[model samples]
Target: MNIVAVTSCPTGIAHTYMAAEALEQAARDAGHALSVETQGAAGAEPLDPAVIAAADAVIFAADVEVRDRERFAGKPTVTAPVKRAIQDAAGLVAEAVRAAEERSDTAPAPSGETAPLDTAPAPATKVTEGAGLGARLRQWLMTGVSYMIPFVAAGGILIALAFMLGGAEVAAKVNGGTFQGRTYEEITDLSALVEQAGYAGVLFKIGAIAFSMLVPILSGFIAYAMADRPGIAPGVVGGLLADAIGAGFLGGLVTGLAAGALVMAISRVKVPRALAGIMPVVVIPLVSCLVIGALVIIVIGQPIASAQQAMTDWLDGLKGANALLLGALLGLMMAFDMGGPVNKVAYTFGLAGLAAGNLTVMAAVMAAGMTPPIALALATVLRPKLFTPAERKAGEAAWLLGASFITEGAIPFAAADPLRVIPSLMAGSAVTGALSMQFAATSRAPHGGIWVIGLIGKPGLYVVALLAGIAVSAACVIAAKHVGRAVPAAASGAAAAEAPAPSERAATVA
Candidate 1:
């Protein structure tokens, strides 16, 4: 059989090429002729157009956008984040191949014998168009989360190192502009000060800044990935503006969509062909950035920042009942969206609150944010074949990432079965969030898993909260899946009860 594939990742870095190699190797191993396309920093290139023309199936292993889906219009295809292609390439390809066979069987016949676009059925059954908004959004967030993982891990380590080495110095660059005020200057000899000044410190600080910028970057790139060149500039600028203005997830989401739309609009406008090459890189970015930046700053930024501050204060001031409610919301946001805007809001607030001496709130936020992935990792461990062999392997790999507070490690499972997986993650995350609040665990570091214990107060309680949350999230996922399955079975039974059996004559005629 002939197969075609496209591989892409946001950074056009390691994962992109890795997935491409995996797909190519898998196709060869399966004795299938294959054509692969890569959409990278350079541009799109089909390995062989003729192979695509003759291919029986297509695989899009991409985190970014594929330029034109129209070319593969009728072919059976499987789409997934690029990392899946690398980590589980052979299995993913096998699944795609099997899906292709099913598609060929179920798909409508070609319009005519000359129909080059085979018009095969999709691999999975189509549901209501609106069925999985949460799942898809979660998938997008997971993509961002995965990409952001390295930034957080690296930043956290640098922060830890700063504390260990610098040890309580009130240096000038250590605290940056924030230390200008005596309020911040008096912040005990924690030596979180040395992080910004040391040789490697700048790199670590940059990583921290990058981590903070991650969601907006992902949101923008994701829009770009989906919408193509038209989407890149607007998405990125809008994301940055959203961050500057304090527009949370909702705002970032709006900006992401708007950026893509803006791109689409520009693409429709007629422009000189000679200028086309510069449009995406130069013209588009300039115009789109101006428009998006204005909209965010003027329309959305101030209100969001105000509201976020207000919410942060309320949570900080919480004594008993109020604390519980705030904790629930923080936990929900942390796990609900992974590292999306909602997650960022809670996390950012936590970090900011710590600077303001509201350590308890920060503790809750970190605890919740770290729980989902770790819990999901554990779930995969316990269930074994509940996940594919490749997924199980990825799950094991996630342990290190999860320990380092990299929530992106959970993306693989979430992408594979979003509906069943996320809620499980959220349940654990919420429990962790709530437990942290109850214990009043406090942390100074913005990012770190359990390793932040040294930088935090009440380390034992923090650990307890972390473990509790993980347990709850894991249990929730397993139970939720079982419960969800029953609902589907009930629906099927009800459908069966309402339908009449076919008569022998009718059956024969049919």
Candidate 2:
């Protein structure tokens, strides 16, 4: 039998290539012709078109979704966990050949005929498009947000380091920052300011430069999501217009959507064959950006600037009940889905506030985000009988994950029993958020959890708030599980985090 295969693993490290090699050796020993594609960190060379067209059957050994899976649609396919190929390659290969016989009996394309692309069934790995416009809009915006975060994290941390080293008064010595009304000399020139503020000035200026790119990066990526690479130039130009008019991040959001829509519309129009070659490079970018600039400057700029100012003012004045309510809301959002869309919304709100120099919101959001995992870890230890051995093992790693502010570390437990776990997490997070706000805790850095404690205002009180929330969440988990028949966690929940990264995804395996 002629066969084709694809192999992939989550990290795309050793396992992907290992599986491919195992399958290839098995096929050679069985005296069958086989070609394998390994989608790994090393790289993937797609199977030749002729090879795919001639294949009698296919096998997919993947721990993650296969890219462009429609290529194998209607073929007799055997799918299994990636490790299965490494462990039982001969058995899996036999299954594929047997499955091909059944496939021929059912949907007999002529012996040499290949299925047409349009007629192929949808791939199993596809996320449904039936989710509607609202979901797609959120996804596009999130693409931008995902790209924007690195800029914020880097800039915010550097600024915190500047303040830490320069005694929190370095801004007063910079070029025309809000003067703190003290008897001190300040300089406007970059060269002079560096000399006056020393290394603190250097760090602050570098951070400020990075911060300046935040709006443009967000806008560009949003447009990219909507219209692919053709949308980037116009989106960036729109962001520049937004910054020029003091419209801030809100203006950038508006400009990004507009740029993307415009590009999409332009792309659909027919153009002369000679000109079509340059349309993306010359026509679309030039035309779309001009429209985006006009829309920002003549239409939407001032209203967004006013709105941005109002939001900044409101955040600056947040205290008492108002602060507590906002904090609790943010907390609920963070714990709602752990690292899903709802969690991202709350994080984005905090980032917006951080950019506007409202540090308190950032503090509350981070505190709430850290609560769920620690709470789960504590619950596993304090009440081991309520959890399976696998969950208890996940709990051990959750300690470092939680301290590092990786809320997704708690996802394994949440997925097992969301009914009991989610509410407990939300309740604890709300408490932490409220307390952090009430204590006027502030974070100069966007992330780092307890490691960045020195950059947080009222760090002592912040720790107290974290501890309080952890206690509440853990107790709730233990109580909730004890009162109910504990559901056995899916063995697959163990895939939650073999490696930790600040911005990595928590994608589900099929």
Query: What is the per-residue lDDT of model 1 for residues 355-459, given as tens digits with 9 covering 90 to 100?
Result: 678888887887787777678778777765354433455566566556656565565455445677777777777777787887778876665566556777788
Which candidate wins on TM-score?
Answer: 1
List where candidate 2 sits over 4 angstroms from the true fold: 1-150, 175-188, 242-254, 273-278, 297-299, 306-433, 437-459, 466-510
Model 1 bad stretches (over 4 Å)? 1-75, 78-173, 176-203, 247-254, 269-283, 313-330, 333-366, 379-426, 437-449, 452-461, 477-510
lDDT of residue 436 for candidate 2: 95
TM-score of each model, paired residue for residue? 0.55, 0.46
Candidate 1 worst ten-residue window by lDDT: 120-129
Q: Native-vs-model 2 lDDT? A: 0.69
lDDT string, candidate 2, 223-282, tens digits? 866676678899989987876776555567778889988997998788998998898789
